[model samples]
Target: MASFEVKGGNKLNGTIVPQGAKNEALQIISAVLLTAEEVTVSNIPDILDVNLLIELLEDMGVKVSRPSRDTCIFKADAVDADYLASEAFRNKGGKLRGSVMVAGPMLARFKKAFIPKPGGDKIGRRRLDTHIIGFEKLGAQFDYHDEEGFFQLSSPRLKGTFMLLDEPSVTGTANIVMAATLAEGTTTIYNAACEPYVQQLCKMLNSMGARISGIGSNLLTIEGVTALGGTSHRMLPDMIEVGSFIGMAAMTQSEITIKGAGVEHLGVIPDKFRQLGIQLEIRGDDIYIPAQEKYEITTFLDGSVLTVYDHPWPGFTPDLLSIMLVVATQAVGSVLIHQKMFESRLFFVDKLLDMGAQIILCDPHRATVIGLGRKHKLRGITMSSPDIRAGQALLIAALSAEGTSIIQNIEQIDRGYQYIDERLRQLGAEIRRL
Candidate 1:
């Protein structure tokens, strides 16, 4: 139950580097279990969820070596498949949603995978039906025990085949792709999630001798191979963090530069911020957001209200919608913030409204933010974080508020961002973690 005592009203001014992609690191690190050879990955975000998953891997007897702060080499030659069924895994693996991804590699290499019900942010119902059905289509059998809350999967030499996912679940696509890579035949996946995270996973798998085509598209083709070897891969810059910084800069009237942002991999993210009338300059690989008194929300061409919503890749990511909603509170005009992916994420607007922001909570999935238009500054208040993305949005709001704010349950924030308070301190933000 750690809390943050934030003294707001100070504009940040400095250069900060975005951490490695947390979502991508989860999928990429889980793929290490697919082969016995050494696989090295760099640019891993030092976060709680990732460390928990790594500990889960080590508990299953994978040799993990950390040569640097952001580098890890995994040797799964002695992986303990039996450990997946043990009580230790049931207790520990259930803590992280990323732990579910280990099922893909475990089933591919050991022909068996077991997991208790996974735990993560309670933003919405994150179902595993996509992952389960995908595996069943690839010659695997699935069984679940409702009373015990565990899923069991086994395959006697999986043979790849064509499958269409009901939704482009990011984790589902990663799981099926990893399983299909070592199967006996070819696999074609339609309606797959093609986020930069998934695309990077496909590239990393290909570097390890898995033949996968269509790197950045919803349809992926994979040719099975007998085995995969070791390869080194680096994670892309966290687009969520990049978008969060963009929102923070505009909300707090700060001049900040994000270093090593991987601009090309971030599709539609910068443009979406620009739609909020935030001016961003792309200087090489970095993104520079200049201080502004007030940014205006752009109206549609027909002079209608601006709408910001999430979609699959090539559209704005859902992870940043919370941040965008907070930024809209200070913008010069009204805008609609629609979080289509998660039903309850928009409920945090109640906290923002308590802080003096004008917002109408239309429903579980939508919020209409009427910007104070810089006519009134948001006052700080005590709040608790509900989820990772919402926690970050609150942090940004607190930083831009008129007085001190205390945020409890910051462990939710630590689950994703790496040393967030320390990083924000480098940018002259007044945030203290307790």
Candidate 2:
């Protein structure tokens, strides 16, 4: 169990490159099961979840070799064994919720797939019902056992049809797209998640002979193909990390540049942050944040309070709401933050309150942050991470505080960000991984 001890009140002033997206890399690696040829993925992050997923791929008979620390070459030509029945596969696969993505490609290519209950942040009831429903809409039959805690999907030939997802669940949408790419007919998915991660997955599938249209829209049209071939693909830069860096720069009053930021992929990130008076400059593919002593929250025209909320794609991403909430704590105005996705996500605001943040927890889904506007500085204290995003929020708060702070349960942070401490340290943050 690694922990981070951060000595705060340091202005991080340097340039840092963000790593590849963890969410997208998981799906891209899982897509290897759809082809028998060798697939090489570059810019892979050396994180715990990625390593575990690679182990799961190898256990299924795929030959995984790492020519470099951050590059992986995978060949699924010999993956003839059943992946779901192995305990080693089940145990490690259950560690991260992204493991559910394997159900689509495995079932599409091999005619059946067995997956146990997936594990991830215990934020709320993240039901697998959406995924199973999507598969069933495509003519696949599911036999789920509650006591055994295993789900089995079998289909002779998947006949694609119109699927209207109940909600825009990210992983559920990706699973269906992967399955539909190799189905027997045209598959139309409405209300599909159009996040950058899903878009990258579609682009990667297209490069391998799958015909998918509406790459950046909610309606996805996938034309089924007989089979797919292997191709090399690079994962997109992490947008969540970019947002995190923006928050870090603002909190520490540092001037930092983030390299390889996919500017086109950030639909509403810059403008959303602008609402908080955070200025950003896009220099080709990089984002530059200048040093600022203080920032103010922009208000509505009627002189009413402004609220930052999360919605589906093109709207603000729910994943970055925590970082934005923490950023709001230091801005020079008052704003209401509504986390509409999960119930327990806003519960971590208590820790920030302990650090002298002026936060009013309206309820489980809302919080009002009253910024001190540089007048008040958060003091350092020991804290524990509750989830991935909240862990990141706490780290940002710790970096801007005055004194030393210890963050325990850092494994939660490791599940998402790769080499977080090292990267922050490079940006002049006094963070040590203990």
Alpha carbon lDDT at 332, candidate 1? 91
- TM-scores vs. true structure, each candidate: 0.99, 0.98
List model 2 lDDT by residue over 1-434, tens digit each.
77899999999988888888888988999999999988899888887778788888887889998999789999999886475766666678778787888999988898888777878887777888888999998889988777767888899989889988999888899999999999999999999999998998999999999999999889999999999998999988888888999988999999999988888988898888889999889999999999998889999999888899999889998889999999989999999999998998998998999999999999999999999997989989999999888999999999999999999999999988988998888888899989
lDDT of 1 at 67: 94
Per lDDT, the best of the predicted structures is 1
Q: Candidate 2, overall lDDT?
A: 0.90
Candidate 2 lDDT score at position 98? 79
| Residue 82 of model 2, lDDT score | 70
Scored by CA lDDT, what does every candidate get?
0.94, 0.90
Model 1 CA deviation exceeding 4 Å by range: none
